[model samples]
Target: MSQEVRGVIARGKGAPVEVATIVVPDPGPGEAVVRVQACGVCHTDLHYREGGINDDFPFLLGHEAAGIVEQVGAGVTDVEPGDFVVLNWRAVCGNCRACRRGKPWYCFATHNAAQKMTLTDGTELSPALGIGAFVEKTLVHAGQCTKVDPAARPAAVGLLGCGVMAGLGAAVNTGGVTRGDSVAVIGCGGVGDGAVAGAALAGATTIIAVDTDPRKLEWAKGFGATHTVNARETDPVEAIRELTGGHGADVVIEAVGRPETWQQAFYARDLAGTVVLVGVPTPEMKMPDLPLLDVFGRGGALKSSWYGDCLPSRDFPMLTSLYLQGRLDLDAFVSEEIGLDQVEDAFGKMHHGDVLRSVVIF
Candidate 1:
């Protein structure tokens, strides 16, 4: 059966997203209909509204989400009705060349619902990142529904579906942060704070938080940052070197996708330390010039972390359990709980860096 649900949609570029009635179809083959409990407003949703990603107008926005499985289509064995799950965009296909190489994180192909979801006027809607959950109910591939510990709060745990997971994965998985390691994270946004928390959880001794915003730096402290570097007040690269005995950190995670921050991350690492770029840079942005000899002199890896190198099946469940155990401070990420109507206001606050995440709860 088709269902009419209230959802947020971006009709065109640079236009405000509208609350509209979207016709969500029943689960098709390999898809599941999720009764969304909560969804987080992320920068990607705003990117969709601005047409920064692509010209997929009438896009159903909001992907960082969690919900209960309401129905599963044919051959969907991963989840069943009544299961609590976090929606993930990456539904890795096991047969991809990357997966065949035993690195499913680099899976060349990911899956989404084969069928189309449309607006009330019958306009086909592109689900943001292929798993929009701002609506009361959404249809997505079963692989997108990662079953997790039901005890975790929907709004808090759902964040793992995107930014939080990306940040954490950037540090633990991509950066390979380890105990006694000195780590620095640039851009103390939700994702940056997640990297800070991930570093702390991984036993990093000195987790430096870098950002111009004092409020965000404070927020990062709550997430386990041992040192806070206000980039506006001091030269972050030199400060990082001073903090780490003039050598810099063992791992530096660039959570701000700007060329300046990327360059800061490049120079703010130890001689053989890793640099992880998890921030999404705009196409107009070009890499800054640096000495090629320095690149060769640095003996460690400089990697780009896509979705924090997340494996939904493995990471989501483990993160959920950690949250339940009171180890991962998921609740700290939720700055406010709001109804669907407040999404636009939430975006405004997000733009001002006034809130970490304003979650929409159904």
Candidate 2:
């Protein structure tokens, strides 16, 4: 039997989201229904509401979430009823070429629930990032549920479902930050701080955080940044270089998606140092022109991270454990918790740059 639950929905572009009745179907083969405990309001959800992602109007918003598995459909073994899990967008497909090469994190064909979630009137909803979670209960492919420590707080650990995970993976997985390496993260938002925390966890000796906002830079310090650079006051490229003994950092992470910031990241790393782009840019933005000679002279990898290049199955559990052990401060990321009805208000807070994350608690 299908269940009707309250969910946040953006009925059209530029329209304020509202709590509406959504129909959540029973898990079919390879699917599962999750009783969402907490869901974070992400910029991506706002993008969907603003029609920035596509014409997928009537978008079921929210993705970063933690929940309990209400039920599992037949043929599903990855998760079962009563299990505590964090919802993730990327559910790796084993048969993909990337998976075959042992890089399942790069699986080209990620999984989403095959069945459509709909409004009470039977209008189909486009789930944001294939996992609409700003609801009391939601449906997803079984692989999208990654089991984690039940003891962890849903509001905190749920963040690993998206932005937090992306930032950490950008530093540890994509940038290959290591002990003794000097890492400079541009943009001190949630994603940038995640990189700062990741670099700290990886034992990077120096973690420099750069941002235009002083408050965000202070937040980065809480996440383990050793130094903060005010990009508006100083040139980030030169500052990072000076901090690294005139050689720039070993890894420079661009958490701001603008072309101008990316250009700074390019020149803020030492020779052969990696530059990882974790920030998202608009479709209309073009890559800045670069001297081919400079690219050749740098002699290092330039990479764009997709969801922090994370494998949910592997990273979620490990990160959850780290959170439990007190080494990772996931709780610091949650600026406040709101009810589902306040999602529209939360979106407004997102624009003010005052909150790191506004989460919806069931």
Candidate 3:
């Protein structure tokens, strides 16, 4: 039976979101219905509400979520009813070109619930990231539900579904931080701080957190930063270089997604070091002029991290176990708990740089 659930919806472009009753359909083939426990209020959710993602109106606005699987459709085996799971946007399709080459993380085609959850009037709603979860229940492709340790807090562990995971993976998977290496992260937001923590967790001796905001720098320290540099007060590239004995850091992560910060990351790394761009950039933004000689002289890999280049099935469970063991401090990311109706106000806080994450608990 179709069930009515309360959810936050973006009615139109740049308009305020509202709490509405959405009708969640029964599971279709290769799909599952999850009873959402908690969902994080991320910048991407705000972007969807503001129409920065696309013109898709009446968008279901939450994605970073954890829940219990309630039902599954035909041919489902990986997850059964009552399994605790983190909802992931990327549901790897085995037949995709990337997947065919044995790179499931880069799966060219992902799947979502075949049936759409609709409004009371039968208007189809677009789920943000193909996993609309800012409600009591949500429908998704079975592959989108990655089972994790039930001992972890849903609100905290669910964060691995998005920003936090992206940050961690940027360092460990893409940046390839290693023992005794120095890593400098530009922009000390949740993702940037997560990069710092990931570097520390991966045994990088020096983790430098750079940001314009002093408050965010303080927040970065709690996330395992070995040092903090206020970019407004100092040239971050120079500072990171000086801190790393004048050779720059071994790895520099750009998490601000601006051309200036991208340049900073480029110039703030040691020769043959990695530069990982995990921040989302605007389409209108243009790259600064670069000498062809400098690109050749740098002589290292420059990479962009998409969703942290993570494979949900492999990373989610490992991260959840780490969270359960207190090795990963996922709880620090939650700045506040809110109801679904508070999404708009939470967006205000996000805009003003007030919170790390305001999660909606159902």
Candidate 4:
């Protein structure tokens, strides 16, 4: 049997997402149905609505989410009914080459529910990031559900499903930020602030946050930034070097996903320091022209972080525990709680930088 549920969907290119009656099929083998408790409004969701991701029209828009397992199909023992889980887009397949090599974070063969969720007239809907939760219920592979502590707030911890995880992992996992290191994060948005918090958690001695907005820089401080640089007022690279004893930071995270910011990150790091690019760049944007010799001259690792190079099964539970212990302020990421119908309005607020995350609560 199929269940009719209310879900937000983008019908066409650059069209406003609408709440529609979606037909959600029951969990099939290796799958589970989740009763979504909370889902975050992320920029990727808006990108799908604007047709930036693909021409997969009528996309079920929302991925960063947390929920309870309402039902499980055969062979789905990792999570059972009533288990609190964070939905991850990456559902690693153990047989994949990346997973066989023990680097499941780069797993190339991830899984999703084989069954498709659709509209009333039987039109197939593309679930954003392979796990759409901007609805009352969603179906996903059992591996996509990372069970976490139930004590944590859904609206807050749910962010670990995507952007937050990407930011923190960019610093901790990809950049290898360590004790007494100096770290600089560009564009203090949700992802950049996550990097700031991750750097702080890793015991970075000096964490510099760079952003054009004073308000965002202030928010960065709450995430444990040691210093804030208003990029509008000064050259970020020079300012970061000045703050780091005339030597650039050991690690620089570029979260803006623009060529200009990427250049800033490249120049803001020490000779042998690491640079992590966690931002998602658009297809039309091209890399800025730079001297080829600089790439070889800089002797440091330049890495692109896909979902922060994170292994959801390992990171989500640990981060949630930190949140529960008051060690990680995940709650700070939730700027507001909203309803499903308000997602369009939340998109506007997000564009204007009015909120860090507007989560829909069921």
Where model 4 places Cα greater than 4 Å from the true spot, the runs are none
Instruction: For candidate 2, give the lDDT of residue 266.
Output: 94
lDDT of 4 by residue, 68-89 (tens): 9999999988999999999999
Put down candidate 3 lDDT per residue, 100-207, tens digits, no spaces: 999998888999889999999998999999999988899999999999988889999889999999999999988989999999999888889889889988999999
Report the error of model 2 at residue 345, Å: 1.6
lDDT of 2 by residue, 141-243 (tens): 9999999989999999899999999999999999999999999999987888899999999999999999999999999999999999998999889999999
| Tens digits of per-residue lDDT for model 1, 206-310 | 999999999999999999999999999999999999999999999999999999899999999999999999988876889889899999998888999999999
Worst 10 residues of 3 by lDDT: 281-290
User: What TM-score against the true fold does each predicted structure earn?
Assistant: 0.99, 0.99, 0.98, 0.99
> What is the alpha-carbon lDDT of model 3 when measured against the actual structure?
0.92
10 residues in a row with least lDDT, candidate 1: 49-58
Candidate 3 TM-score versus the reference: 0.98
| Model 1, residue pairs in steric clash | none
Model 3: colliding residue pairs: none
309: Cα error in model 2, Å: 0.6
